[model samples]
Target: MIACPRTLFWIVLLVAACFLAGTTSGAASVPAPADGPGLTVVMDNNYPPFSFRDANGELVGISVDLWRLWEQQTGENVQITGLEWDDAIRRMEAGEFDVIDTVFYSEERGEIYDFTAPYTDVDAVIFFDADLPGISGLDSLDGFVVGANRGDSTVKELQEKGITVRKYPSYEAVVSAAKAGEIVVFILDKPGGVYYLHREGIQDRFHYSAPVIRGQLHRAVKKGDAALVTKIDEGFASIPKAAYDDLDRKWYGTPVAEPADLRLITFFAIVAVLIILLLVVLNHTLKQSVAMKTEELKQELDHRRRADEALNRATQKLGFLNAITFNDLQNAVFSLSGFLELEKSLPADEKTLAYRQKQAEILHQITAMLRFAKNYEDLGMKPPVWQNVSQTFLIAISHLDMAGLRRTITLDNLEIYADPLLERVFLTLAKNVLLHGKTATEISLSCKRTQEGLVLVFEDNGAGIPLAMKEKIFERRFEGKKGLGLFLAREILSITGITLTESGTEGQGARFVMLVPEGAYRFTDNS
Candidate 1:
């Protein structure tokens, strides 16, 4: 009976050894499976190429492949589960899973999980509107709201760096928000972001920075799980180099190596030869078509250039003629004003005096109109430029007689993209305060950063504009009542998507706020 029991034990051991050898012939370093329950491996369900559902809804990716290889090598039964990244982490921390992959190593994470050697590196990046200039890295995100995926390691990383990030549910959601114009700046993993950007076909609308943070992805267990850690490490270490490389090639787009077949090579060579022969036959036709298209395009461009030149010449001639006419009109108005003044000195009846006063008022109106025309003629003649706010304000004040009034500017080292007439905007504003701001003692200019963009505030402590005239003050028809400078200022700002609005208490002051849209203003180092 004793011999029989011993023989049965030997038979059982032989069968188990045979099974292990068959499963992992070259992987001797892999430890034998523990006798208890199998491991539960969990990973992100939507992270493509690293573990995501295929079109058929089957879970797949490099992480999935590596785990399966580990299972085979170690002779362990691993039940793999796919969940959203946050849920996966939450469940694993809840003790629902024994292992998790596709996780980045951070100090906070290291405190909760025991990480294995890194399997891959993922770069985190910042993507902003292509038109938003001067944003080179994280330091450039000051005063701007940034968006990111909820529960991502990147969010924590950014928070640690003191960057304020708006969280979305996923990278796809971030891209959708950007497309909807809800967000201008966002963060995401480079590969995933590129995938969604290309899929949405809005890749050209955004610019991304170089890797802001490179997270080494690893498979980890709850902290203090040394047994499981050892198994995972050894299991992966035992995988053949070629097998590991194959996984990378299959999922990460590295080209696969294959044995060359002479038959296949010969067949491709013949096809290439046939293609070349056909190309040679069609080369003359293609060259003729291309040459004709090129010549046609060249002729069209030449015609467009000549037409542009002709239009410019016509514009110049009209301006010259208008200038001459304006000069003649000014001289005539000047002579009329002199005659009216001379008439004023001569004694006249009441009715004649009223007629002479009316004539003088009409002449003054004509002179104001002529001055407006001269200033308005140059509007939009030159392209918009970036002007320093403080410097431009000084220039505008230089052109005005700002005596008896204290001028205050708190604009910092800010700059704006506006038409060259930007100077006219400040000049016109200052002139309005001097002319209309009765009881006004001080004029102040400042800026406030907001979600929509920058608000340039121009305020004055004066009798303030009557509530009724706020909107009408910018109307073209109001030009005769309140001069045309305000109307002209509105037009100049609108050319660059900036808006002007009056928002102040009637008794407090006249507050004109110019809304400078994002991408139209930036702060310098002095700010």
Candidate 2:
């Protein structure tokens, strides 16, 4: 069981204060473009594979190696101070460190600090006694006691998801409780969790569950260190891909799994297809039945034909009058605007010219609205049909200028049952990139299989939608940009059963994910 809320507050403050006084207060100033005191970087002392004391008592890990590389790259010296996790946070607030390494991202922390993009991906896993079976995820923890490090995000996330968490002083304590059956399960970041299990020689006593949350590791820099932040970001971007892969090999001490190859992806994709309920509607007997019905209707229609001819004459006269009225009004407006411009060229009063200009602007707006209405009338009027994804994508891209933009598509084998307006969906998406994706260098379309179905991803390497606005961007009458494009695109896709969601990070890029459920998609194979 956890301590009461009030008791936990005092315990945390007391612990932070006790470590604060003993932790060395470094006097280094945050680095600048030139001539600075470098940086004081702090991290938890025992987070192995990130920062920890080796058997030789040498401080080494991914974070240490990165800082060393930064020093070599920029001629900037950095001081690494190791303290308890709680103490590191406290000292950072006291300005003892310019950067905090090995920090996880969260909204609350984001308020006080700026972070570099994730330097490493981290996974949170559930660990249980080895004898326990069927402990795969959070769902398996119900009706069982669980332990968490008192101040960990894993604890907060669990509690927020409505699980009861027994708080321990540290992660090591949580593992001990789980192994002793004091708690049925323990949750922690996988790398550190794996390390402690081995260090305690209890690796054989417990087993790990599938990852609970796949998160990232970021460096937390002071809020105002824009220059230093820029350098940090540049340094990370400069690091070779092989550097991280090699480090993974050294740290995990195993052959790490790479991203699935195309062949394997295709194999698993075939397996994951749950059902193939084609939406095509046809009845073999309907043609013959309709022919017989038409013969019978023909006899009856002879009598009705004369009455229909009379109604047609009346309808044609009314349509002619409507067309005449619309044309006359448009011609009159144009003539009036021409006369007003001619009057303005003469020595006319400024007020009179301004009034004429206002009238012209109103007429222009009316014309624009009329055009919009004309185009809007045909929407959703056509029957939905099977649209070839690659062909439609090619048509949409062909309409764009394609001057400086690059488009990549991998949807060759896919087709979806959607409204013929499906072409407009891709068109609108491309137009959005042109209008708003100022930084985008490329636009891409691709498909991948998920447990639910296939996802059609439209992505651009431009400024991404903020998390706050992910859903808001799709609202029909959102904060007032032309939201109609995406709104109509969503409606068109919905004529079948595809749903779209935006899942990109705020700064990474825009990713529009359209989930096409089981019955909506099929593959075209060339035999």
Evaluated with lDDT, which candidate comes out highest? 1
Clashing pairs in 1: none
Residue-wise lDDT of candidate 2 within 382-498, one digit each (tens)? 545666787777556544554456666687579886667787889988888888888988888999988999999999999888888788777654134467578667766765568
Q: Candidate 2 — which residues are off by over 4 angstroms?
A: 1-36, 133-136, 139-143, 240-249, 252-527
Listed per candidate, the RMSD to the true structure in angstroms reads 20.2, 22.1
Q: Which ten residues in a row have the lowest lDDT in candidate 2?
A: 1-10
* TM-score per candidate, chains pooled: 0.48, 0.40
Task: For candidate 1, give the lDDT.
Answer: 0.73
lDDT string, candidate 1, 1-527, tens digits:
00111222322332232233233333522233445579888988766546665545667656776776787777777788998777888899899998998888888898999998887767788887764655678887765567888779878767877876778876678888777655668888776676667667788878889888877778899899888898899998987787776544343332222324555777899999999998887978866897889999996775455445434643564476478657867776777777677677777877567767777776766776667667667765665667888777755664454545776668868998777788789988888888878888888899999999999999999877778888988875423566467888987787677899888888887899999988779888852
Output the worst ten-in-a-row residue range by lDDT, candidate 1: 1-10
